[model samples]
Target chain A: MLQGNCEILKREQLTETIFDVTVSAPEMAAKAKAGQFAQIRAEGFFLRRPISICEIDKAAGTLRFVFEVRGGGTEALSRLAVGEKMDLIAPLGNGFTLLPQGEVIVIGGGIGVPPMLGVALSYHGRAKAILGFRSRSAVILESDFIRTGQMPVVCTDDGSYGKAGVVTNALVEQIALRRPDLIAACGPEPMLRAVIEVARKEGIPCEVSLEQRMACGVGACLVCACRTVKNGEEHLRHVCKDGPVFPAEEVLL
Target chain B: MNRLAVTVAGVTFRNPVITASGACGFGREYNHFYPLSRLGGISVKGMTLRPQEGNLPPRVAETPAGMLNSVGLQNPGVDAFLQDELPWLEKQDTRIIANVAGHTVEDCEEIARRIEGSAVDMIELNISCPNVKQGGAAFGTSCMAAAEVTAAVRRYTTKPLMVKLSPNVTSITEIARAVEAAGADAVSLINTLLGMRIDLRTRRPILRNNVGGLSGPAVFPIAVRMVWQVANAVKIPVVGMGGIATWQDAVEMMMAGASAVQVGAAAFSDPMAPVKIVDGLAEYCADQGIESISEIVGSVHPWE
Candidate 1:
């Protein structure tokens, strides 16, 4: 990966907690794929922040990344202006697998919504979305789905908007209506667990993107690890290596 | 444009700037940032006979200009390294130096034998990991234990072997001499010093293990003095490292009697620091009209 400074082309508040940022990384954007990530820096920060590749326009040499201001690096990222330059290490980790056409359900919660947006744009055939947020203010990327003409089901904890429940409830309702052949989810640990449980019960194939505190962002440090059950034995796999995505059943909740 | 080439134990490195063990992690991560072929060499993470899960969380903590880590030598077993990591490493242009650690003599022997025919160019016996409770720092603290482990590995591999010494010991000279006399091709020192940080609010140690190895800019002077002492005591070549962040620090190590320097803790501050140090050293040499960097090695202490 080449580290370079990219001028921010645009920045918009998708929600109170999340921001959709587009930067100009010609080399990165030219090569970036749907499932990969970028290690971005807020200029003076010591550590680089990892953000998923939300979208890319190879010809225009612009990359879109969605991030929430949870930590210091992201908070710093939110303060940058349109023309400000940011150091970014892109296409750093493995991306999502492009599945063949099948009945698919893309599930996301809060910040996890961005990773699935690209997949939704690529895969054809019957595709539905189950989005979860704490309230209306936390929900994001709904318009992108609506623009794509895929009517999505949304869940908010306080009934502030959409269905008044967790995304899992929305998922169960959707599955009851018609089971999807494949289920994909990314969100907080609890929501992912619920989604996995629902998918397992319905006998639908499912995958979940995991998050762990990481240093090095590569497989070497052994810092960002998640326990997984493989061959009937549990072992630690680097979240940056074995996956940011893994079959839901294989991961140890 | 410069001769970054360095020779240790008759083996030539394309450049003197090898990626320090535990920092570069088999060289794959850095490969993402730059070309792996650009490095002089890469010391793989400390390995063992069997896979280790290593210490608990909060394994690392930041201190003033330095950081403490009790990673506890987390590594996949020798078998896993051989089956999975080795073949991948062999493809790289950089030299592979396996940093091995163990809880016992037999463990070291098994790991050495396992790596005998592998593509690795040398073995760095990591007897100096202070964070572990078992045989690591214990062997490094005592000359007798240092000699014993070195001899065990020497019996297995004819490849050049470097004994990594600990700084926690009272006399680093004694440990250096012991490893040299025990058939070590070279001796590298001083590993991160044993240290701990206090969390005032919790009124307890910040690290989950309560202690960790201190590395980075804070440990440079200590490492330089230890390298000087050890170099004087042993005939074997010395690879010195502590908080080497720039070319000047590297030059200090070389002048202090280090044949080559390893950049640790500094890598966390800047992933490309080693490359910059290598470039800076070349520029420094060129301006001084020095033909080879080896000319400046041990050039300090003219009065002595």
Candidate 2:
């Protein structure tokens, strides 16, 4: 990924809270993967904020990142004009592992949904996507998911639209009906933990992406390590190294 | 054509641009951006005898053109590195320098002894880490303590020793001489200067640690000055770091007496900085008609 400042081409609110931002990084788009992320430096900020790559069109030479305005950096990103340039360090961190021989079930909650969208688009297997939001205004990417032909199952807590329940309720029903061979999830910790527990009961292999407050996203600071039980051994693995994506059974949610 | 190389205290580096310790974290995450073997070498994060929790929130703050960090020597401890990181780092073609630190002289020695026969190319005694409550910054500020710890580790292994000195010391030359007399093979300076930032609204320190080590472009001039002073005083090869983000900065350090320059805070800005620096340095030397990069090492003494 190139380091110099590149201009922002577009910034639009997909949902009330979630915004889709596209930046000018031709090289990053060429090798961009669904699970990889970019560390973005807001013009006045010293440290860059890590945002997952939501979409990439290599031929078009464009990269897009979806972020929920959670903090100063992201809020700053949402306020920027189209012609403004931003310092972006892209295509970072390990991404989703492509598994063969199974229908893929993609699950997402809140802001964790964007990164998984890229994965669903890339998967060659039969893909079923389950999306969750607190209410209708918080929901995003429904049309995009449909455009991918996955026809994502939408769940809202308030019953403003779609299924009136947590995404897991929809997940359980999907598991019973479709019995997808593999599962992937990215969301709040509790939701991922629930998904992991569900995937385990069905004996289906699953992967979960995590988010931690990180400093040096490159693993130097040792700031964002998650404890995982692997091979019956408990270990602290760097989220940026071992993964932002880990097998559901292995991570200590 | 020769792919210019540097040999520091008998250890060979394919080039002189190395990823500084505490910046590149054993070369794993950065490997995603470029091949880990592309750099001259990588100095792993500082390892202590036991796992350290480091500092609290707001550990890093921006100061003018620099940044301050009180990360408090947070590491996975020596055992974890030996088990988890060392084997993987050893497999890479680049040189691995183990940066060792502790709360006491014996602790430093114990950790160094543990890595005696491992794949580590050298030992960089981190006497400059300012985040810990004990032994880290304390030892580097006093020549006696610096010598005590340097000699303690020197007795255990014959591996090359590179003592990292703090700029907070009253006389850098005295500390450099102390480590040199204690048998250090080389010296690296100047570790971040001790400084703090104020959060005007809260009317307190911006960093939770109250004080942090300052680094980045703001400290480049100071680091070059200290490297020049220490390099002249001890006769030991010096590795200079602090705000080195570009080829020009690397050249400035080498001319100021650094045999090799370390890239720290700059890595926070660009993960592939070390690789870009390695490539850029070569092009710069080629354009300058310099046969060997070593020719520019210490070339700034006359200017001073």
The candidate that wins on TM-score is 1
Q: Model 1: per-residue lDDT, tens digit, A168-200?
A: 888888888887888888889899988899888
Candidate maximizing lDDT: 2
- Kindly list the per-residue Cα lDDT of model 2 for residues B86-196, writing each as its tens digit: 999888899899999889998998999999989899899999888887888899999899999999999988899999999987899999999999999999887888899
Per-model DockQ: 0.25, 0.22
Model 1 lDDT per residue over B1-304, tens place: 4556788887787777777777777777877767767777888888878898777655666666677777788788788888988898888777888999988999999899988988889899999988778879989988889999999989999899999989988788988888899999998888888889887879888677789888888899999999888888888899888889899999999999988888865665466788888889889888888888888778896564
lDDT of 2 at B54: 72
Say which candidate scores most in DockQ.
1
| i-RMS, each model, one decimal | 2.8, 3.7
Total backbone collisions for each predicted model: 2, 0
